[model samples]
Target: MPRYDYRCRACGTNFEVSRPMSEASAPASCPDGHDDTVKLLSTVAVTGAARGGAPAPPPAGGGGCCGGGCCG
Candidate 1:
């Protein structure tokens, strides 16, 4: 199951749901029973090891280390 983000057109509410790919395409109703919900395109962050078993480094400047650059 993939997690998807959705936005309610009627209420302008945003929510996340986990469902199958087939169900993802269909329109979903809001928890408030409004039939104006639309799925929003969202980006997911993924982190793991590489194919050669090497761990991936953290994102640049993510450590708050002077934007990943050493002091002059």
Candidate 2:
């Protein structure tokens, strides 16, 4: 189950609700029993690079110091 964040306008309290994706848009009440609530926008963060794809080759003409002949 996914958790949804909500805020109660009547009591100015924030809460979370766990429900299915189908009910994502459904109305939720705050813990304070306030029905005047609104769902808060959530942000997702992606960490680490994706795997399985071949690594990209170094830039042409060797742009880096080690590849551009700077260290050589």
Candidate 3:
């Protein structure tokens, strides 16, 4: 199940609901039973490195303005 964030316009209350992706767009009621609720766009935070491996270094020799002294 995925969690979705919602806000109630009636009481200005924010809450979260867990449901299936199929019902992701379904209407949700607030804890105070407010029907005037809207689904909020939420940002997801990804943690940890993939496969327990460190991140790869940036590639070198890209002749950008910062690297090529064109901006200097």
Tens digit of lDDT per residue, candidate 3, span 1-72? Answer: 899999999999999999999999999999999899999999999876657598644346555656655654
Candidate 2's residue-wise lDDT over 13-68, tens digit each? 98999999999999997887889999999998765534766656667777686667
Model 3 scores a C-alpha lDDT of: 0.88
User: Candidate 1 — which residues are off by over 4 angstroms?
Assistant: 51-53, 57-72
Q: Model 3, stretches more than 4 Å misplaced?
A: 53-72
Model 3, residue 15: distance off in Å is 0.0
TM-score of predicted model 3?
0.73
Which 10-residue window of candidate 1 scores lowest in summed lDDT? 63-72
* Index of the highest-TM-score prediction: 3
RMSD each, Å: 5.2, 7.7, 4.3
Candidate 3 weakest ten by summed lDDT: 56-65
**Candidate 1 residues 3-45, lDDT tens each?**
8888899889888888898887877777788888888989888
Q: Sort by lDDT, best first: what order?
A: 3, 2, 1
TM-score of each: 0.62, 0.64, 0.73
Residue 57 in candidate 1 has what lDDT? 68
Better candidate by TM-score, 1 or 2: 2
Please identify model 2 stretches exceeding 4 Å from their true place: 48-72
